[model samples]
Target: MGLYHFAKSLVYGLLKPVYRMEVIGTENFPKDGGVLLCSNHIDNLDPPMVGITAPRTIHFMAKEELFEVPVLGKILPNINAFPVKRGMSDREALRKGLKVLKEGNVLGLFPEGTRSKSGELGKGMAGAGFFALRSDAYVVPCAIIGPYKAFTKLKVVYGQPIDMGPIRERKASAEETTELIMAEIGKLIEVHR
Candidate 1:
């Protein structure tokens, strides 16, 4: 297997026993075409948890600082993780994300831009909505609900793809689309939490 799949399998093997991770609504994922997986972040483990559970490989836009870490910096790129500067527009990162989707790959993103300290879904940034409107990819909302206690259940729930047709046709602003995405994430958390 390739590095990404190998790492995913390894993580799954290790985390499954400890967290009793349960994945729901994976059937909601499309089998092919570009897909944007917009999820709410809660813990440091959120990215890997969602990556392993999703049916397809997810290329993530991780914080740029993560790339400066010693060993992890080298490993992240190999596992399909790229760096994105937070708290700014970061056009380069946005371009990279668009490129990933344009190539018909799955691009995983945390719409909230950072992890929540209180474990509640926070306001989403415009990035998720921007990508959805810019690309023809299916925008799938995901929720990672967990206290991440060992031997306890941690759930990753994938909600149905948000229909961007009407929004697109109406030429809705990215902020509006972001609100819709965050709302969908909230609903998923409500059902699965």
Candidate 2:
């Protein structure tokens, strides 16, 4: 098996015993083609949780600081994790994200840009929308309900793909598209709140 697949399998196995993980709306995922998985960021585990739970091998746009770590810098790239410089419009990271999608890979992103300290979904940044429009990939809204505690039930629900008509038609700005996508993510997780 490929490195990504092998790692995903190993992590999934570990998560199974640690959290009562439930994945919903699995059919909503595109069988192929570029896909942008937009999710809310609650904590650090959010990315890995979505990665292992999703139906496809998903890549992530992690913070650039993570890649600065000695060993992690070497390992992240091999596992499909790329660095994104937060707090600014990093063109290089955006380019990498577009490339991954163009190659028909799943690119996992959290529109919020950072984790919410209150566990409440906050305003989203424009990065997710930018990538969505640039790549013309399917935008899948995902909500993660738990893993707040070990051995606790955690639910992840994938909502229907967002219709990117406004984005496609250039009728909406990146900020506006981001708001719309974040709204969908919020709705998906409302049930668990």
lDDT of 2 at 193: 51
**Which candidate should be chosen as best, given TM-score against the real structure?**
1
When summed lDDT is taken over every stretch of 10 residues in candidate 1, the lowest stretch is 14-23
Clashing pairs in 1: none
RMSD of each: 0.7, 1.3
TM-score for all models, in order of appearance: 0.98, 0.95
Judged by whole-model lDDT over C-alpha atoms, candidate 2 comes out at: 0.89
Off by over 4 Å in 1: none
TM-score of 1: 0.98
lDDT of 2 by residue, 28-70 (tens): 9999999999999888888878988899988899999999899
Best by lDDT: 1
What is the C-alpha lDDT profile of model 1 across 115-158, one tens digit per residue? 89999999999999999999999999999989999999889999
